[model samples]
Target: MLNQFLDNISLPAATVTSATAEVQYWKEDLGGIGTVRAVNGVEVTTEAQGVISAIHFKSGQYVQKGDLLAEIFAEPEKAQLQVLDAELRLARRNYVRIKALLDRGVTTESDLDTARSTLDQVVANIEVQRARVDQRVIVAPFSGVLGIRQIDLGQNVSPGEAVVSLQQLDPIFVDFSLPEKNYATVKSGLPVILITDAFPGNSYRGKITAVDPQVDSASRNFLIQATLKNPKQHLRPGMFAQVSVQIDAQRKVLVIPRTALIFAPYGVAVFVLEPDENGDQMIAAKRFVKTGEERGDLVEITQGLLEGDIVASSGLLKLRNGESAIINNQNQPPENANPKPGNS
Candidate 1:
């Protein structure tokens, strides 16, 4: 009766695809939130307290270094400059006349010295007047884009009062912070990838330019700066950014397709191929695996999976433990694990 019952029971094979868990290159990325800033930025301010005389640059204008932006009340200083120039010329003429007379034994040495002293005093006065006149003019310290105009014509601006904001947007800086544990891993020149809400679905590439020497005691994180090229000026200062730093070079690791994973209430598992009792046919053996970072279609298997071990890539819903499997590699999915959508 037992032999007759066993003869009536038939075993069926399940068709599935299998992939070898081989060593593939993997990179460890450290992620952090950052803010965009200009490499050189400043609030243009007045050094001299005077009424504005003329405005040269418009709001949101691109200016070159040393370009005049505005001018204060300089009429008084300019008039003093003219008086100093006349006095210097008159003193110089008197000095030359006195020196000629002394050479002819007609004028004393004291007279020549007095004329030379007068000429020197006038030259010094001219230099002081020139400096006073320059103080009224506001010039851009560096080449950059200007912000909104803060002062109007005939407005009295005091010293240290903000006039405008100047920022060099090209080759901008991104400042981010990393944990203290990753201190040794991060350094200058590491490649960085940035994304901001201002420009969605786009990535900006840059490299680490500076790393803070000390870590913050409160947060135990250190600051790092990366330089990104902004030729189009799409990235503005003070914008929020998400940053990823590739800490190390790509190294080989055991990897498998993500479709192979079976989600269970207990843990994640996968079906691996094993030999049957006769050693001729392959059977599915459920394996609980520890997973690491995931890159698109591929996942890093940290435990319970070895290199060269074949695992099921698809058709996992119907598979059972110790069940017969038929691997078909011809109809496998594309192996491109990580596909960049909007990155250049």
Candidate 2:
């Protein structure tokens, strides 16, 4: 009879373990490798067919727009221009003489008109020859570094043939790709962090300048381009880069320790401690919480429990709804649970 009475009064030693839930911020990092390249690259070419009489600029030299890069032999075009100039002078003299004669009634109206037409033709020819001379001199179209010269001093080059390569190094571009799933999260003007093996311990910050509208069919990733201001010219073309994009900042949500939750076939649940009628404590039940995104060591509980709830973190797996629990004051419960009436 004594054993039976004790058994009826004794509760199972609650396998109690302490836990506290708090709010925390979480971040997810995604990684991708990319290649650095110039935002503008072009093959510098000659605009007219001629012999390269003089190379004005050396290879690997920085040049500004309209700076002479190479000079072609324009002697033939210049000689033609001289002949046209002489012809134009002669036409002007004839036109003047013809007008004087017409005023003096010595020449007909048709004679004066013919002389005027000849003068106009000569002027047009002179302009065409001048344009040909201008084409023989090759100039830089934009500010950039020139590549190796392809022709020697006396090498004959045809029109439209590549003379060298030029690239704008400052404000270089880094092209990378990200999964199509993150397409909506990434957009123009978002910040990016770039690192490369070539420049150890250095990181370049830039913004997304462009995002491809279409996702690649094979990889299902979209190409993204970032314009990094290389004011120091440290970033070089073709260098590999590791890129990170900062999507957005999210407010920290209420998080619980991962061990606090019990997963069941029906739903996920946690045990809440509440006072029973005898001033003892028992495990109250809160069931079926919806979970949000999880970060390291903690999970966001979206529903079913408030921030201040005293949850049985460790012994939840062995808990039952309305089961009796011993309030061992070994550890204080979370302060948020003990609400002041005004504060609550």
Taking all chains together, each candidate's TM-score versus the true structure is 0.72, 0.64
Number of the top-ranking candidate, with lDDT as the measure:
1
Clash pairs detected, candidate 1: none
Candidate 2 yields a Cα-based lDDT of: 0.81
* Residues forming the 10-long window of minimal summed lDDT in candidate 2: 335-344
Q: Which stretches of candidate 1 lie over 4 Å from their true place?
A: 1-24, 181-185, 255-291, 294-301, 304-344
Could you list the CA RMSD of all candidates, in the order they appear?
5.6, 9.5
lDDT of 1 by residue, 1-23 (tens): 99999977756878898888989
Q: How many residue pairs clash in each candidate?
A: 0, 0
Alpha-carbon runs more than 4 Å astray in model 2: 1-24, 28-30, 102-109, 251-344
RMSD of 2: 9.5
Q: How displaced is residue 263 in candidate 1, in Å?
A: 11
